[model samples]
Target: MPTDVDLGHHGDRDVAPGLVDLAVNVRAGAPPSWLLARLTGALGRLAAYPDQSSARAAVAARHGRPAGSVLLTAGAAEGFVLLARTLRPRRAVVVHPQFTEPEAALRAAGHEVERVVLAPPFRVGPGLVPEDADLVVVGNPTNPTSVLHPASTLSALCRPGRVVVVDEAFMDAVPGEAESLAGRSDLPGLVVVRSLTKTWGLAGLRVGYLLADPALVARLQQAQPLWPLSAPALVAVEACSAPSAVEESATWARGIVAHREHLAEALAGVPGVDVVPDARGPFLLLRTPVDVRSALRDVGFAVRRGDTFPGLGPEWARVAVRDPDTSDAFVRALRGALGQPAPAGDGGRPVGSVALVGGGPGDPALLTVRGLQLLAAADVVVADRLGPTTVLDGLAPGVKVVDASKTPGGRTVPQEETNARLVSLAREGKRVVRLKGGDPYVFARGWEELAACRAAGVPVEVVPGVTSALGAPAAADVPVTHRELAQEFVVVSGHVPPGDPRSTVDWDALARLNGTLVLLMAVDRLPAISAALVAGGRGGDTPVAVVQQGTLEGQRVLRTTLAAAGDDCARAGVRPPAVVVVGAVAGLVAG
Candidate 1:
């Protein structure tokens, strides 16, 4: 650790004027537009003294508790200071690698603070703290490490005389608030402080609240001034605590899970970067070998230094989760900072190069090296739902991910719109990658994207992938072409029924062929296609194989005869995105 470290140093200090900021845990985008409007409306109330009652009731109701049990603070940090000023503890223990405000507050108030630093993975337990300590403060889904402690673990810290304070400032970003203790009123001497700063982008307004028994709330209240929160801050708190706002917060939390996963995987891919595996917070903790924070700043990124946290050293850093584009950009900068190979395109500055990159099947490792390189180098990626999503997780955080997935029976973006988006992005001098599953040319619409880019004067290149037509069959151990049973093979789409006007497949010609037949997207129309083959003189007992979600963890394979393929598929509840093979060779492999 550095000797010149400031114990009070925070993420805000790491941020500069124009960097891709991954330092502060504050939400990336602005507060909800409606929230801002509410605050704007409250501006008229400025003439009045601060009224804390309504906001207090709203917070209480949101937590399913009485109004008396809640105490609104300017922020959770202020609540820590109030606790320090009011509570007189003989032995105070502050958990390390957590938010420093509580411990800093206690120390400033002349209390001797004992540090309880948990090891890596940083989960809290009852045995780690001294039984004699009368005061204990810990952060749930703690800072820097982003580990969410179980509610039972926190509850175990409570004793008759000991007051356990849980900082749940980031709990709102956890889906379902699963490990939160904020709503638990049965625990003895437990105080939960929550902040709206992270989820609602309200750091500047400083709105937060404390939940505890009425008696403790009164004691903490005594240490505060009368007009602790301004009028607008009060309105902000009440407005955000409403039912609609709570639901929106949950949605945001769910989105954070995806963003965090995307950022974590990218960071993990970089050499010398070690990401904590159990991150549930909206930020990630990374440890690198060579002071990547300073190096990152040189590459236009500002990351929070972790040395100030008692249990962390200089090699560690904390980064906030951002939307995909910002995340991709940060990951690219990080790779550059770490001295990794420069991404493709001139001098790593992506120009008008459009890469029709194959995402392979469902597996990330199946992606060709060049395809992965192009992905990392791309400024924009228009992705399909069935593409190698695992590869997306490994992309640079700054890459723009445009979901052009055409989900069946669900809303889908038009192909023309996706084409226009790719061309427009390329026109803006971005390196755009039209990422698709399997081989981009094999039933994945690669040529359409290629033609669009070519017409738009964008330099486009295609990186072929391992097509699932063969990959899925091979994964299921079914050979599309066998030495003795089948001499040739054919692949066709079964997305449309046999008699549909859009259907071009020659079922009779396919049936007469003495070889294997591989059908893609054939699950829904399997029954119709199988009957067509049988009626076209294909033997009823010809073997059939259905492989669903092939090459993935939940993959399933079913074996039957061509005559019963449809019934068997229906009986087994087979779904789309499956491959069906019919021929004598289909029986060669065990399902």
Candidate 2:
């Protein structure tokens, strides 16, 4: 068993910037727009003191209990604290691998807390619990393990003069709310603490309630501070308890079950990743190498650690079951972190289609919504050096990564071979993502690959991304076009020298224009191109700015005139994958 010192540690602390969150198990997106509107409407009422009666009645009605049987608290966590303060149990027993707040609360109030650590499968049995324990706290569809104890097993723990607290914070995520005691009013000493936070995506609002005997509810209510529930929280309590809200929750719960099963199956197939069987919660419990969590974090993923829970070790982790796309992305990251090979799945079905996804400049955050979705679903990701490869760190387990970077003067995978690989993978029924840097169409020869795919009769989807030619200037606070400074902006490739017969850009015409010139793939040719502009009637003193690896952590920005732009870039050894801006707007540094 692990030490109890960090029993209070929660999942939120595992989250950080740029990481795909599997640590916190809140709903995927924001609270629904209607729910947001409801919360927003309640803000105007904050001037008044909280009125708990309406919320109490709503919750009671939702649970099919008397209004007197409900006691609203700041959240389920606060309800645990209240129980610790109010109940004077002769023996306190808490189930292991469950939410730790109840046990922590008990210990804080000077009670010697006993832990009944369940073994694998984590099912609660009569012999496992202490018969003499007067108080027991457990989570239905328990956290970190996602095991749902039968309601009958919970009822058996309710002895006379004893209080049984069931934390069902995630029960709503389980389809049918199976094995949940939230609506059970016939049982004695059964206190069901329910959170509106997870299902409503209102963790910040802190609204929850406990359902128990009216007498016990009154006793717990006595321990609460005056107006413990906020006015807006109360409104949430009421709104979420409405019949329509309950129906919507049930629908989401069903969807969650499907997503969880899909995620679990995929994870189970990954080498070195084990999904706990019969998981019924919104999150899945996984067992892997002890170092896997930190490794995931290093690759832009945040996953909850399991060591804080008693009976679990450093090898354990909890991952929220999200939509299929995100689940796919997460699984890929897991496999990459573990260095595992692809899993063998059913061979009868045709593999999925392919998408040429734009990875968007150098920043993973700039990936388009559709691109992210397609990337998540990809079974094989053929990535480029210029694309945001960090996102590949979040790919689902069993995903194959093919490096297709076309480095000049360096050994690289031939374009034809890459195209053939993509077509073959798609024909084999794999969801393939040809991830490229910036917008695939912006000088990426993506149209050529798309043409090959169409010729081979392989289905393909093109998801556009933020081009660095535009993203770079914006990142450096240098606008390509500024009002009264530059009226138009042209983005052209600098891969070919100005005098090269293959070059399509007319240097003379470009120099004759007064608009901005944004160049991509031009770092190596900067000197020739700058001189060509100077010789073609363009002013030698025209402002020029070079942004290298723009929007990335190692991004660098250089400012100089057109005459010195090429010479200065060469002197500084600026690399390719750089964006160059030339025009009056380049000189207009934003304040």
Candidate 3:
């Protein structure tokens, strides 16, 4: 398919036609040596009927459930298909901001499927679920943006006749197995779906299972194809439960949690991206200023967009948590896409071009190559209060330096008035440079100024700055991109400006965006922020970073998030001129 064509979730990650994928959230690592050996050994036996006996026993022992309770299927995808046929619910409800396959499967079964869009940041509240749903399908540590719901929350929906299916496909990636509701027989009508593909990299083997009462298991088993699970899949099930494999999985899980936090922090630092916190799974959801679809491909990267999922709009994307090298590469490409900026007042009439640039966080070093280029070319400069003076000092001795900056409640010119002066000066034909801290497009009000210039017939161009979220991690010596951690990043405002309805903020999408979250001026509402993230289904103990005076000396970086970030900042005596970045990325400071 063409790059512009809608290839769905699988479309963006194709590096070469049908190869090199980063789209699916499976673990980056290859199958274990033991599993490989088992598959090869099993290959000889495939000519005959498969061995369900040992495979079922191995999985049952691993999950600590009876063999009868573990009904193996070809893959997790098949689990959804089987359920759609077995239960055949008249009206099915699928929770949003997660995977689409289950919903699609349900719809395909000729079932009238209703979608329950998760609340912002992505949580299933009481109001969203339909009153009379006979079957409800949901993914835990969901796909796209991996949001893990608590088992307690899952228990609430369990009823005698209603089929409460929780997909624990990503649970193995989380730190503790205690969080999963799988194999719990006490909950009537509880059907848990699990995938070996994600944790063990077994997609080719096509092995997945269903967890429910024996009767319900029998129901789904009846719907399976003859010899549904392959001989290799049976061997994989046995190998997956080996003591060595179990221990190795635990180690990988720990790393995934740590890496997820690190990636979140890195994304939080990038300007024009919003990464929500408490995402415990191995992937994240990012909301980007650049149309990530085109921009990601242009930059030698690919990711899943939110538009395809119910409830998530077009601007959002789902990314896997990759190693440090890939994340950095993605960030660099993202910077390129957002490089298009227009200076507030000056349409660089005859004066050498005036480009407004965001320096990003506190580290001037993180400034994009383009930002540095424009600065070197400027004959005259105007700067904001937060941007470091040292950055201006680096300018040529012959270049004229002007401070057209502002402080809160200043008698100095308002942003609107200051822009007027810039356009007037630029009209005189002098090389004018207006430098701001962070990417200018973000809450910097660069757009408002652009609108003003357009009205005045002034031409303007913008230079991309490395925002504090990305820079804070970089300056703190943390690599936001860790191959073992995050694959996606999201950046959003800390708080909306005055007169805007969302100036207050909505915790749903921000919370549901399962990645790192970077906030600008978000300190005031820390409690609400934490609650929102928690409500959006983020974990409470996720790492956070508060970077004050980023990229500049006296830079104070306090680490905390959501509920506790405000108190931590207060104790550390951190104040404005600070950017708040919350997520696993904070933990990525190099050892």
Candidate 4:
């Protein structure tokens, strides 16, 4: 049909709060102090409508065109809408996978648009466009693809009856503004659109301009509303077009070149990650083996999804170029997402390594990005029953899975055997993953496995998971530590009763503390534990909550007082693999 692409989806949608944004291509820390000062000073003039004469002239002079040839717009986006409304063409074509706004704007204005989807190395040529197409839209240093088409190639698309609109929105980010068509006035029907948003980091300001023949500019202007741009936006347009601002952008463009190269080189080295070749823009297009956007998000980084753009699929992503330090860290996180290990050190360990990953609160989605990566790369996985077992379904067909589950009063995989298996796998030059429930070190005997791997001289790493002790309480809407209720939380093993000789915990001491108590593996011992707390001066009526199968589909919460916790849990058929929270905050959520 009509390409089946989400034309309205942009990179900004890929970003969320608490994430390092690599999705949006806008330069970070933009609108330098000087530009900010100019815009700030213009705020006083907002009482009056904006005057575009000065701004239009400034843009005209910057590109060596007459004032009549420049049309100041609210932003490059508005320019697309203006052109889409003003131009009447029998056949309109848009080149992909570039910016989608042009096609979207045209479609929104009740116009039919065709797409010339380019293959890898996305280089455009005159042959790609149909001769009968009267209107064509393309981007120089295209978005998502980051491929910069030659100026001659774009000019070749222009003819007497055909209109070739070149979007140079990101041209300023390219060193020396290479391959730009803003100054080409002799080419008939050539309209060059330039935006100040990306380089100036003024995306919120909405300032840009289009350069075309005087007649076309006037026609487009007629279609725009009066006072189309704000005063501050008008000031930004004039100030950014100044020669001094141009020179400053040139310097920043050179810096972008360096940062882009650093990011490209590092990404090229990551396994299963393919960086699109010859990236000329400030961002790079990446093709990954699987859709790792969620994994990357889990790791606190946000990347633009490529499937929204025509000619690209879900496996493709767009990441912005950042400083070398940030690029390096991103590369490392990327390696984890792809289940690859860090480069070997001077110690020259074998390619094989062991990673202890926490599966987190029984939900596969709750697993950390690093944990997912290790599991993906593992040749052998030793997993616990309480961990995210469903994740094993996604593993490669060849991966070997071992059940190391421990059942109460039943068959169990010995701790000693689990440790030996990890060491043996690594020694056999296998990438081994020891996956456990919650935090691996939280009463999981993960340290013992680490010790065994180290004793065997096998390189090892740990990817901490969300421990159920805390995750379970939160999932049940029970705050372990509340300012007015409890300021501290104590997590302890409840595998043994209060008076059991094998127990290491001092029940009386724990009872004396007025804080939240989180007990793991304590369902069978709740009677003795509650009695000990009550006998040790703690109130019997203290609130208690048991969260079973926390974060899983079958998760259930049983609420009661400490004195009745044992009977209530027994009657409710509560089981192990649950977190028991004891404190005033436990009863905050009503049954």
The top-ranked prediction according to TM-score is 2
Candidate 1 per-residue lDDT over residues 146-183, each given as its tens digit: 99998888899987899999999999999999989888
What would the per-residue lDDT of candidate 4 be over residues 218-327, giving only the tens digit for each residue?
Answer: 89989999999999999998898899999999999999999999889888778788888999999999999999999887766789999989999999999998777557
- Report residue 574 deviation for candidate 3 (angstroms): 74
Better of 1 and 3 by lDDT: 1
Q: Which stretches of candidate 3 lie over 4 Å from their true place?
A: 1-20, 340-591
For lDDT, the strongest prediction is 4
Candidate 2: tens digits of C-alpha lDDT, residues 1-591 = 236548879999898754667889888667998888887778788889988999999999998999999999888999999999999999899999888888888888888888999888888898888888889888998997999888888988886788899999998998778898888888878999999999989998898999989988888888889999888899899999999999999999999999999999889778777788999989999998646987787655688988888888888899988877567657866887898754554333464677998888889999999998988777899999887999888899989999888898897888889988987888788889999999989988788677556434456788898999999889998998777988998998899999875577999999989999999999999989999999999999999999998999988999999999988998898987799999998898655
* C-alpha lDDT of all candidate models, in order: 0.86, 0.86, 0.71, 0.88
Error of 1 at 164 (Å): 0.3
Please report, as a residue range, the 10-residue window in candidate 4 with the lowest summed lDDT: 343-352
Candidate closer to the true structure by lDDT (higher is better), 2 or 4: 4
lDDT by residue (tens digit), candidate 3, 446-500? 7755544432334467877776667765666645555656555666676553333
From the highest TM-score down, the ranking of the candidates is 2, 1, 4, 3
Cα lDDT for residue 450, candidate 2: 77
**Global Cα RMSD, each model:** 21.8, 15.0, 22.3, 16.3
Which residue pairs collide, candidate 4?
none
Summed backbone clashes in each candidate are: 8, 13, 51, 0
